[model samples]
Target: MYTEDLKVRFYETDALGHVNNTVIPAWFETGRLPVFELFTEQGNLYEVSLIVANLNVDFLRPVYFGEMVTLKTYIARIGKSSFDIGSEVWQSGQLCAKGTTILVNYDHKNGHSVPISEAIKAKLLQQTHPDHPLAS
Candidate 1:
């Protein structure tokens, strides 16, 4: 699992004084950096070849600017050519949001999805939490 600390920026808030809806996805994307890093060799994390098959977010509560937040990211499941990344956003000890981002491994050169490698699977397994909904 990966834990990233972030502050709800002033610009990220809406008129309601809570974080804007758009900010959640951006934070989730930031929380995914570590996972992406593992897929690429050192010093080349930006060169990714995966596609986002789907993304869903459930905002459990409002997050205001200046609040300290923690976004915990973990592997939810591994499939033949895709995997799910689950994340929970916590603010002041409350579960503020939960979501999943589905990504498919792709061979950009060939322009098609590719099966996940065992080595990569094992790496992902390590990043999964025991309480994951899809965990055995």
Candidate 2:
């Protein structure tokens, strides 16, 4: 699993004083950076070969500005040409939000999904979270 530590900014808070619901998704994306690195060459964005297919987020509790949070990201499932990424946001030991995103390996030039290479699959499997529901 990959972990990212972040400080909640005041600008990310809502009128109600808690972090805006939209902010969690962005934080989750940041946590997925390591995964993105796996698909890129020499850290070049132009070499990325994946696209988001779906996303889901569940808010469990309020996250406040000025607090430190940890975003944990991990592989939930891997398929022939697609994979599911699971993420959790925690503040002061509480789970504030959880999310899942499905991404497909894509051939941008051909405009179609392509099978994930076995070498990449091995690397992804190494990062699967032990607490994941499917880990058993």
TM values, all candidates? 0.93, 0.95
Off by over 4 Å in 1: 133-136
What 10-residue stretch in candidate 2 is worst by lDDT? 127-136
Once fitted onto the true fold, the runs of candidate 2 whose alpha carbons sit more than 4 angstroms away are 133-136
* Pairs with backbone N, CA or C atoms under 3 Å apart (clashes), candidate 1: none
- Candidate 1, residues 7-110, lDDT tens digits: the string is 77888888888998888988889888888877887649657767899999999999888779999999998998899999889999999999999999989888
Q: Across residues 1-136, which tens digit of lDDT does each residue of candidate 2 receive?
A: 9988898899999887799998999998888888989997699867989899999999999998878999999999999999999999999999999999998999999999999999999999988998765432
Clashing pairs in 2: none
lDDT of 1: 0.87
Residue 127 accuracy (lDDT) in model 1 = 91
